[model samples]
Target chain A: MSVDQFLQYLISGITQGSIYALVALGFTIIYAVTRVINFAQGEFVMLGGMLSFLLISSFGIPLIPSLILAVLFTAIIGAIIYLLAIRTAKKASVVSLIIITIGVSIFIRGFTREFLGVDSVRPPFFTGDESLTIFGALIRPQALWIIGTTIVVTIILHLFLSRTMMGNALKASAISTRAAAMVGIDSRVMALTAFVIAAVIGSIGGAVMAPLVLTSYNVGVMLGLKGFVSASIGGFKSPIISVIGGITIGVIESLAVGINWGPFTSSYKDAIAIVALLIILLIRSGRLALEERAD
Target chain B: MFGFVKNKWIYFLVGALLAVMVLIPFDWFMGKYNTLLIFIGLNTMVTVGLCLLMGYTGQVSLGQAAYYGIGAYISAILSKTYGVNPWLAMLIAAIVTGAFAYGIGYLIFRLKGNYLAMATLGLGLIIWILFRQLSEITGGPDGMGGIPYLSIGGFGFYTTFKRYYLVWFFCLALLLISQNIVRSRTGRALRAIHGSEDAAESIGINVAQFKVKIFALSAVFASIAGSLFVHHLRFVSPQPFGFLASVKLVVMAVIGGLASIWGAIFGAATTNILSDELLLGFGELDTIVYGLILMLVMIFMPQGLFVKLKEIIVQWRSKTTQKV
Candidate 1:
């Protein structure tokens, strides 16, 4: 690829990666605390975009306030999901828990489609749609917003986990719920907090990225799967690794479009993510066997 | 023979099945419920295998659709394009699907619980994408058609009436074989694994091998169902054979009481009716109801709707006996 083409692909890849990172962060948080993959994480992202669109265009709210409200509303929905679905079925098996989350995802998508219509909608861009020419490659200001927000969120998450008492307690609960409880940390509360925080991050990602890729109700299904793939790349452990996985997937997908074999095109682009998921899972299983042998 | 009633329930079920088979040739039975019965048969074929896997082996698969699609597409492509016999095509598809399942089962069965589910889900999605993307072969999203039907001698199973009987014949035979397995050593080993994999392992059971075998068996079952379905519809598409279809198969297994072989019949019949009759009107809203049903059943009665209903029937029967 030429320099300009590489830069163009690079810019779009990062832009997509930022969204994946946010969704992966959500997946990581929930899995870390509850050992449950909140499959509805991407739905929160969808809600962020859809709710913002509703607020700004139909509900007559300004752009800035609508964005904040949309994120907050989605987080509240996340909390409700935790309280209603997850809390009541505490003793359920692993299979049931996964099904419950999938059910919740479908329910959200169903309602969104019923209420919001199936059309793709985008919020007004944060900065006007002015394309900047850099080394003969065009870049949108919204791309910068996405990249900047991801960096800011990553740093904030790092400081919160390492420095703040609540964050540390959350981390502690994730490590050892029994020990944390002995230290007077309520694991239940911590679990709920994880969902809320994850939802907030996901919704922010959705709302911000909306202007770039138009949002729809069914968008969550693919996005959520991609995010799950990304988090799995980290083995659902480190935040930084998850972010890298997200970016890698993003770049691979964009590059799939740039380089074309006659048969494989953008149509099979999503398969790249699915392929990545399978490869990561196979690698993990292999590592698991090696560790067991070592043990 | 008169004194030998090892299981009264089995006798009753056998009698009922016989009656249905006899009545199926009649217009009264075949005219109104022909397609419905065909779908129920197809679903039962898949769900029974799932029962053996989930109910007996205690593993979950959210990607049965991948195998189902494989069976359908393989049969469709071979019979339609290459002039292969439909029956032969189906047999080849089942074997191919089973082998595919065994190969992936090695990589996936190593991961327990949620990770395993994710792996299967990815596998299912990948196949669905291939169905849509490989346009030259699969006809892309529009799917492939003009597939020939299975036949015996010179008599083709083309009509809904003939197909219904043929489908149910296979479905019932599979059910019986599965139930027989549940009584045999292999079935006992499966239950032992489900009770506790580690305990089963310590007792000299080959856990990995058993799990992979059951996974492959379930894939074969799903493949058979897919073949029957495509031949029945005379077209094969990626739409029906996707993640949601796999989920629906699981739902059938769950609602039918996963542990019981007969429950697959009840679950498939009820769910097919719900989708065919109820969803035909509401369209997109069917998902909302389907999701609610899945959550409600899993939460309130994890043992499944069929099992709970059986319990109630037994309770009421005991009360009547007390009156006597």
Candidate 2:
């Protein structure tokens, strides 16, 4: 392939990758704090997108305010979910928590269908009708927004987690709940904060990506599953690693579709992210076992 | 006296109820729609297997529908292409699905919790995709048709009423087997593992073996149900065995009460029938309604409807004794 084609694909990959990264960050934050993988995290993204579409298209709200409203609404919803469904199952087993989260996800998905209707909704792009041509490849203005937003969000998150006391307390709780509690950090509040942050980021992802891929009630399942896969590929260790994993998977997937491996190409594209995740996990576990044996 | 009446008479009443169910086809009032109950019976078979895995073994499989699809496709292809009898095709499907489950269980059951769930979810998605994409062989999205109806003693059971009895027979047989397994020593091992895997391992239980075995057993049941479903419907599609179907099965098992055999049947019937009714009348909102039910059940009735019923019964009995 030409360098220009490859660059175009890379740019497209990075745009999709930014969305995945945001969702993955949401998953990681929730997992880090609560030690519970919120299965409904993807639904928050769907809600954001659908709500943005409704606010912008239906209500004629400005794009920026609609996006902000979508993010805020999703954050509140995440906190409400934790308070209502997850709190009761706090002492329950991880299996129960997983089931409850799945239930919550389904409930949200169902509620979205009821609220938004079954049709895919698209919001007007914030960047307007502008396309930039570089090396004979056209790039949408919103693609730049996605990439720019991802970097800005990452920096803000780093600052929030490091420079702020509540952020440090959240990190401390993630590390050791007992120790954090001893230090007078309320782990419950920290968890809620993580949920709020994650939801906001996830909503931002949904709002940005909604124009690229139309927003529907069922979109969360696929996005959430992919985000989870990205987190897993990064070993769920660091947010930076999670973003890298998301971008890597996204680029590879885009390339697979671009290359067009005959009839199997479309099928292979869907399977690629999952296959990469499986291989990474297998290799990681193998290395862990070897290290254990050496020890 | 109440305990004796409840325990002893309930069994007889259940038997009579089942017998009446079986005899419904002979009566003139039964119609073609009564055959839907056979599908319910097949669902019960699969759900019972799922209940054992999820409830007793404490392992969640989102790939039960994969096994079901495998059985359906295998049996359908075998009977259609090779001209194998439906009965023999079903048997082969069960064995193939069981063996496939064994291989997958070894690889996947190694991971616990959400990891296992995700892995199995991937597996199910792969199968569903394969069924859709391999259009040349599996007929793609249009699905395969002309599947032969099951036969016994020179009688072709193709009608809905006839298939109802056939499916009901298999359901009862499977239920009996499931109940027996649940009451056996192996059941105890599974429960122990479910309660706490680390504790079960400490007590000398072969945790891996029990898990793989139950998983395989569940696959067998699901495969058999799939085979029967294909035979009855005479058409097989990927949509019915997709990831959503697997999720629906899990939801049924949970809503009906996991680990209870009768609860599995009740759950399958209730959720399936309710969904069908809601969807037929209410359009897309049915999914939302179903989701609401699932969330409400998990939040308020984590132990499930069966457990709740048992609690109420116990309370009623105590109240009656106080009056006495």
For each candidate, the alpha-carbon lDDT, in order, equals 0.87, 0.83
lDDT winner: 1
Predicted candidate 1 versus true structure: per-residue lDDT over A113-166, tens digit per residue: 888888999888888999999888899999989989998998999899999999
Interface RMSD of 2: 2.6
Per-residue accuracy of model 1 over B1-324 as CA lDDT, tens digit each? 633653786799889978977687568656678888899999999999988988898888888878889999999998898989888999999999999999989778987776777888888888899999888999999998888788889999978888888998889888998989899999999999988887999999999999999999889998999899889998988998887788788778888987889999999988898889767776567667667777788788888899999999979987997999
lDDT of 2 at A128: 84
Local error of candidate 2 at residue B99 (angstroms): 1.4
- Go through the candidates in order and give each one's DockQ: 0.58, 0.46
Give the Å error, residue B162, model 1.
1.5
- Docking class for candidate 1: medium
